[model samples]
Target: MPFAELDQPGDDRGELVGLLKRLGLRTLGDFAALAERDVAGRFPNDTIIAHRLVRGLSHRPPLRRALPPELAVTERFEYPLQRLDEAAFIAKALGERFFTGLALHSLACTRLAIHALTEAGEERVRVWRCAEPLTASATADRVRWQCEGWLARPDDRPTAGIVQLRLEPEEVIGGQSLQLQLDSIGHDVDAAQRAARACVRIQGLLGPDAVLMPVLDGGRGPGERVRLVPWGEPREATQEDQPWPGRLPTPSPALVPRQRQPVQVRDAVGDVVCCNDRGELSYPPAVVVVGDRPARRVIGWAGPWVYRDSAFAKQRHGRIQVSLEADEPNAGEVALLLNGAVGERPNWHVEGIYD
Candidate 1:
């Protein structure tokens, strides 16, 4: 017989098997042959006990029933809540009640869970870890944050309004008096509470997606370098952790237009300037025409940085980015991205504007 049954998926005892194998013990017979004192000295006491049980020398204890947490509260809506604000309002009230209940027992919540049921019978749940025991206002902030994330995603939206909300304490600790510094701890906590409340109010007024937070991400271009995510959503740490090459050099552009704008570069006699396959310019640019506006004289121009699209080699082959400066003081410098290889008919669009 096998000394250990560890071939199953998600087997956590592979380390134990490896350790025993390293000690030249592959089967129960080999394990049983070892002296009990030797086994105890070589490995942990638990392993020695397990070996004893397998040898019929020791017996196992009876399993005990697990108990659920004591602090849990649920609220049902008379009219379902369609707006996130409405749900947040109810969640705040529920948080107050949850804390009050815990206070009666002289306890504090260290691990919190929030659950919601939509009219469509879909259930959503989230758990939050508290560094320390949380206060009532802090609990409400967490509830608001969870609700915002739920309502922000389009597919996660309820078919009807949410009909039920539940708050449960996963872990609790004995309540203790907190010694706080007035200027430091108290001020910081108060400021954070006010900010969290303000964020919820702003999200309620402007809509969830409207109140976004900037997240840094790895990309080769200016616009791709920054990702905007809904305020309550978690931002990945790996976004800014990885090294990104070919990013625009600092002083970065003030404006990066998501929608490409058509622009033309022309020479002195109004001949449209272009690039050739040899990565050479048709002529030194003399004028720049943006949309229907009159052409402004070009003072300086730089770069034709080539970027290859390895993913779509057939369609969007590559692009060349160039920065142009116009003579008119009002017309600031702008960056242009042109599609096609150096030697083909180039199609250009405005990429960014610098102040």
Candidate 2:
């Protein structure tokens, strides 16, 4: 609501309001009802200004005075915080106050950093990031989670009691853009903000690396095309958009092993299958042995797709994907990647399981 005093009677305006009153204009509403052109002509420049103020077009104390400083709310303990519960309560109260200040200014924090100082002068700091603006409840939950995790780790706990806590906004956006109308963000925006909050809490409980977000990059291989980064950390740049010759064709493999596991592919004649120098398989796969599992017959197989790495000689490799005749428990229509090069027997490993 607009300030009531802007339109109230007996405001400290001098002779202008006195003349308006003498002219039977008692309230600001009476002055506002006058035509702008008439008000501009009948009285001094202040009369036009008063009319605009009454109509809510101009602020009594203007909004253009100065932009507020960045949000940095701090709470200092007279007696240092000894218990985790005490720190958590302080954090909750701080979050409420901090976000409340932002709300008053029509602003919201997109990135926030938490700083904790111990009596011994040691400090622990971590920044939390979000795609959408965070709510105060989410901010408090994150703070509590972080405090709990720090207390739980005896090795990393504060040497002395914590004397000060600080919450600083690293980045902020206009809250009006996000809060002006419900349809501006839709329902998914709320869900996404909640999910981000949960992720922040989980990351606090575990280490930062525990929660990762996938980033797509330009690369020839399936594994190279995507990377996982820890939450709140900046993503490393890669040639993700670059076109490369001799890259594997899409649709790429759904599963790629983090650590390659070795197995054996055998022909019906009990000969180990091999990829020749010409990138051709010596024999069709019949039996597959994966990590001491009973040999399963091969149902179908794809290719000896060669991948050449000009930068590294040892990295040059070839791969063949095959379907197993017998499915492993919970792995329907199991597929295996047999990867190797010429003059060496190919090693079979589970690639992916079709649903």
Candidate 3:
């Protein structure tokens, strides 16, 4: 008989061992001399099994229950599920079944593994781990979320409908005790769980690239100081040293592109007053038509101030560009401006502005 079958609640292993240890009946032959009723009276609940074991009647029966190598639940669909919604529904069901089995064993899972089989016989698998053991509903929700992510990828979609789904617990561990001192600060594990769930769901529907977080790169330039990366990836929280001298203490919220347009400035008297080049502006301006005609004029001017080139994009020509803000009444809106010389016309183009 399998060891698992012998380990059942009413098996003679425990009582026989206990009685033998107490009476010094170490051998099976010694135990076989004991009367059935005598052993039966000694252990009320397991007497019959204990007597059989003492009589050398092969107390172990054929294996009745089997132990799984690992805790898992699997479902094979008669029909393949083609839609993401259908797959998610099946995932949820599988999650519940998987968790139900774990709960029966008084176990909680910290890691979840999902597997999918397509009608074309292709298999896809994904694994996720959490900091804490999760409930059945939470586990199911996470499985669904992970399924959506796998389905969202262009290269990951199965050629045929998904015909198989499985959820397996990959890790099991104990839960941590809550800290009483941190209660007033409102930091709790539930919030983390909710955030994890939300992230998984969003990533499932929109792909992992959709979620991002800011990281510090530790350089003097706007491009150098900040970087965008996937939400869960580890990144340095702060920068240590400056890359260049004369860095701005306050960085602008937005990073405008380097390429811009150039413009010829004409004054109110209809004379070419100035040509603005290599200039930068902080904001957009109000635009109007010059001389009441269709031609636009910049009414307000801000800056031709120079700044360092963006670190995010490489500068091939090695020239720093200036940003400019201008108001053009002809455009009938305040806008931001960038100018680059366009074949001697010195064309003026509106970039964007505050409302």
Candidate 3 lDDT: 0.57
| Candidate that would win on lDDT | 2
TM-score per candidate: 0.58, 0.66, 0.41
In angstroms, how far off is 345's CA in candidate 1? 2.1
| Top candidate when judged by TM-score against the true structure | 2
Displacement of the residue 84 alpha carbon in candidate 2, Å = 2.8
Each candidate: what lDDT? 0.68, 0.74, 0.57
**What lDDT tens digits, residue by residue, belong to model 2 across residues 280-342?**
788888888887778888889887777676656664566777788755577566776656655
How far does residue 97 in candidate 3 sit from its true spot (Å)?
Answer: 5.3
lDDT of 1 by residue, 168-254 (tens): 998788877333546664356768657656765565445557567777676656677778876555565455665543344555566
Q: Roughly what TM-score does model 2 have, to 2 decimal places?
A: 0.66
* Local error of candidate 3 at residue 343 (angstroms): 25
> What is the Cα-based TM-score of model 1?
0.58
C-alpha-based local distance difference test score of model 1: 0.68
Q: How well is each residue in 160-190 modelled by candidate 3, as lDDT tens digits?
A: 8778888877786533322234654667757
Better structure of 2 and 3 per lDDT: 2
